[model samples]
Target chain A: MSDQEILRTTGLTMRFGGVTAVNNVNFSIDHEGELRCLLGPNGAGKSTFFKCLTGQLVPTEGTITFMGEPIAGMDTHEIVNLGIGIKTQVPNLFNGLSAYDNVRLAAKRKHLKRQAIEKTFDMLSNCGIENLKGSEVGLLSHGQRQLIELAMVLAAEPTLVLLDEPAAGMTGEERDRLAFLVKEVTKTASVIVVEHDMAFIKQIAKNVTVFHRGEIFAEDDVKKIMKNKSVQEIYLGKSADAA
Target chain B: MEKSILKDPGLYVMVSIGLLIMIFLPIMMDMFAIMQITQYVVLSVYALSLAYIWGYGGILSFGQSCFFGLGAYTFAVASINMGSTSLPFILAIIIPALFGVLLGYFMFYGRLSDVYLGVVTLVVTLIFWKLINHTAGPQYAIGDARLGGFNGIPSIPILNMPTANGQMMDPIQMFVTFMAILIMVYVGLRLLIASEFGRVSISIRENEVRSSLLGYDVRRHKVVVFSIGCGIAGMSGAMWATYQTFIDPNAFSLEMSAKALVWVMAGGVGTLAGPIIAVVILQWISLKLGQLNIINNFVLLGLILVPLVLILPKGLLPTVKQWSQDLWTIWKKNKANEGDTIIKESETVNAGRRK
Candidate 1:
């Protein structure tokens, strides 16, 4: 609701039959370029919450507002048109198409014809994926494919980017490059990364939201979150009785 | 943008040669052969309607004949009522397009796709077939034109020049008109596929979820493409009606729908020219088989088709294209004294989904 806020969610919740995937929660991110990380164990509701934001899933109860517009339960295209870039957990790409074409389409959507051509090449190079431009994405390695999707999402020049486990299947060197590319994106857009890699999180994230039992158990500076006793206990799979 | 479609030297040459052949071949053939080619031209348009929707939009319907039959019936009834041949063509195109919009809205908007989409289309065509079959009574008349059920509507008006005082097209004039129409439809589709919207449609076919997340209205695009294809089918149906001077429920038959799928698959699914050429070749084969009478026409056609599909799973045209590309690459490598680099380039040419 505030001018500084790019996105805000009020009492957001998602339930599947008997189980609550994302419990009631209120969350917001600033309009300023910032890299925020969502960290949680396997089923701590981070991905569900991300899906709700991307309009891939309609929450059982909640309201998601982006840039003064209500986007919760809106069509995926409608949500995307509101200046949000979305990437699912896996690489969702046009596998049959060349990588150049994949980025070209995204760039074309957000710019004029001439500018689109320029931006497509620029984004491809910026993401360090210019080499794979002519290759079919389906045949590319997992890390390379992830970077291509990153280039595509960045090509649109969105105000907010929601990436789910972008470095899920990457080597250490690839993760380092991904971290660099993601930081470059944060210079222009607000990025929310849902990831499990603490080392990767330490590299790019400033603010980290640690989710536990379908709720945000801890929210702090990345350095502080790494050392907090309670957060450590939750992350280590230690119960209160054992502690 | 469409004008630039024929700008490619290779494609431009091929299209010009193909058109010239169509124009000249009728001169050498007898009236019977000319009329048969006209029939194939009309069917080419129908097959193209399927090619556009399924090949590009990735929405395969087993009941494209529903639109084809609607156009035929619309032209028949409207021409008979108006007592003029010219205006009914437009109605033929518009009615089926309107129906496409209606049906596409239900299927795409409701997300009823894939196998369900195929079944829904199949059921729709069958419903049309059943509905038209039951219109045997005089009460089924639309104004002056009666639905004669299985017997069909005869004495239908033939096509006339739009502003030539109702002068009907003769055999030669009709042949020329049909050829021109076929060429325009083919070029227009090529233009459409080369545009930004067309590229986006291809991307949607590759991955619907990704296209949507990338800010494309997947359902709306599919609906529009489906409707455009329906309109083309209607135009071809009108052409068929004019040629036969009869309209029947058989226009909506399952066999009519299946032929479109077969022609597209047999020739090639992705190329615009593939389905059109396949329709003509297969129709000719069926005609030849009918004359020989050594085997059932459909069965013999199937016997040939099965082996063709087995040998080249990607379809006739695409495999031929890949083979040509490979040959060209090998020649280039030999001439330039390059080996590994040319081989990689050749693989890129052969395997890349879109040219």
Candidate 2:
């Protein structure tokens, strides 16, 4: 919970062919044990920015530093080893493996065999799918599979976690459970959730960053961000008019 | 120890069948048949190398014969110069392994896609085949062994007992030796697959990006697995040289590579026993068909493989495993239903008696 910067990106930009997906975005996160939700419309470049931070995409023009070390050209595995966990837009668990195995594999990187097994069970339990540990991840429902993927990220015990659209296909009850889980995770690790669902964001977000057209449109507390005119114009649209 | 082996029915079945063949086959078959079986055993080892890479490591190597040919050549050259079997055997394994590491470094580190990797390996095999075919002159001689080109280098020394100097192995001894080596290789690969390294490799096969994000160096793992597979292929090549007592450029031909792929596909990828069984069955069928004058052996093999491939896309062993699992689940469900019916009947009887 210390006020030390865990991640910083200076003028981060990603270009694919002639299109600039993420343009000159300067962002930093200093809240070590707090949840930060990123709100953006489709093609607003939040996913692209997340990819750059997680080393899935190297920024064409920007410098990304994690804990004051340059991580722009580092490999994804190397970035993970540096204690950053990422869950992509799609649930990326190994479908053939059991839920326990998915978490155990990630835990194996940071723990001994015996400890990893124990930690995997704990993670699955925390995610409220301990009963599904023996079930193959592929057989689980979308929400259950998403939970397993989150448990895998938690098993790694990362200092920073980046989640992309974690509750995309969840039921309302599942989304509420996910919101609680994200809030709980922030107590131990810094969490940045990129979500489009304003309801889900409202449940967990204390600090919010609204992205528009590959740039940061607004950065403020949830209450203030909801009232921001530009964020309302781009995101809420008709809903804002009714309000 | 006994309980663990008994837990795995497939292992138990494979071992019992292998032991029965080793013990009884020699008594039942003639010397010529035993010799042919030994050749098949050698080829089974070659097929295993492909299965390990293709099935387990998710690497499709279309030019695996490059390592096999290199191993045979190294064995022939070293045996002729050193006039000893021991050093030549070691050289056969080491030379191919080193070559695999070198080639694998470029392919893996350069981030070549799977198709490109196959193409590069196939081209490398062709290069070796063409390069060795032209070495037909006196200048191509190494020590007392002359590079005979298409005719091949003949009268190559067979594997000898390490303790007994100048003592060549008899056909029976070679047969037993190769079978023992094959068994050891199978066990070793099984142990490897059960290890942490094996789990990581399987994860890599399932999803490379997920494995990488979990802090696994995907490229390094690929290279290491590819090299090990190449080394195994080389060992098989060394055995082939010893069995035939000749080494040739045709060892590096595309035909050898294609045959290996067929053996793996027919047997099953991913499982060690599958490829071994496939190679033995195919070799036996090919030999039997060779006696016939009407059909070519290659065409006969094609006929057998086409149906199997079309019917069972996952190959023999995996399909069998899946079917068995399905049957077991059905049986378990039937048993549970029977138990529920009995309970209901008892409850009805109790109510009638009370009334």
Best by DockQ: 1
Q: Which whole-number lDDT from 0 to 100 does residue B295 have in model 1?
A: 83
Please identify model 2 stretches exceeding 4 Å from their true place: A17-19, A210-218, A223-229, A234-236, A239-243, B1-9, B141-146, B323-355
Fnat of each candidate: 0.88, 0.76
- lDDT string for model 2 (A133-242, tens) is 88989988888888888999999999999999999888888788889889889888999999877778788889999888899988999989888887888797766445
User: RMSD to native for every prediction?
Assistant: 6.9, 3.4
lDDT of each residue in B1-355, candidate 2, tens digit only: 0134336677667777777887788889999889989998899889989999899999999999999999999899889888998889988988999999999999987888689999999999999999899999888988888988877889899999777778999898888888888877877777677666887788898998889889899889999999999999999999999899998999999999999998899888888898888888888898889988688888878888899999988888899889999999999999999999999999999999999
Best by lDDT: 2
Q: What TM-score goes with each of the models? A: 0.90, 0.90
Poorly placed runs, candidate 1 (over 4 Å) = A1-3, A15-20, A212-218, A221-243, B1-4, B333-355
Query: How does each model score on lDDT?
Result: 0.87, 0.88
> Residue B31's C-alpha lDDT in candidate 2?
91
Error of 1 at B288 (Å): 2.0
Candidate 1, residue A198: how far the Cα is off, in Å? 2.1
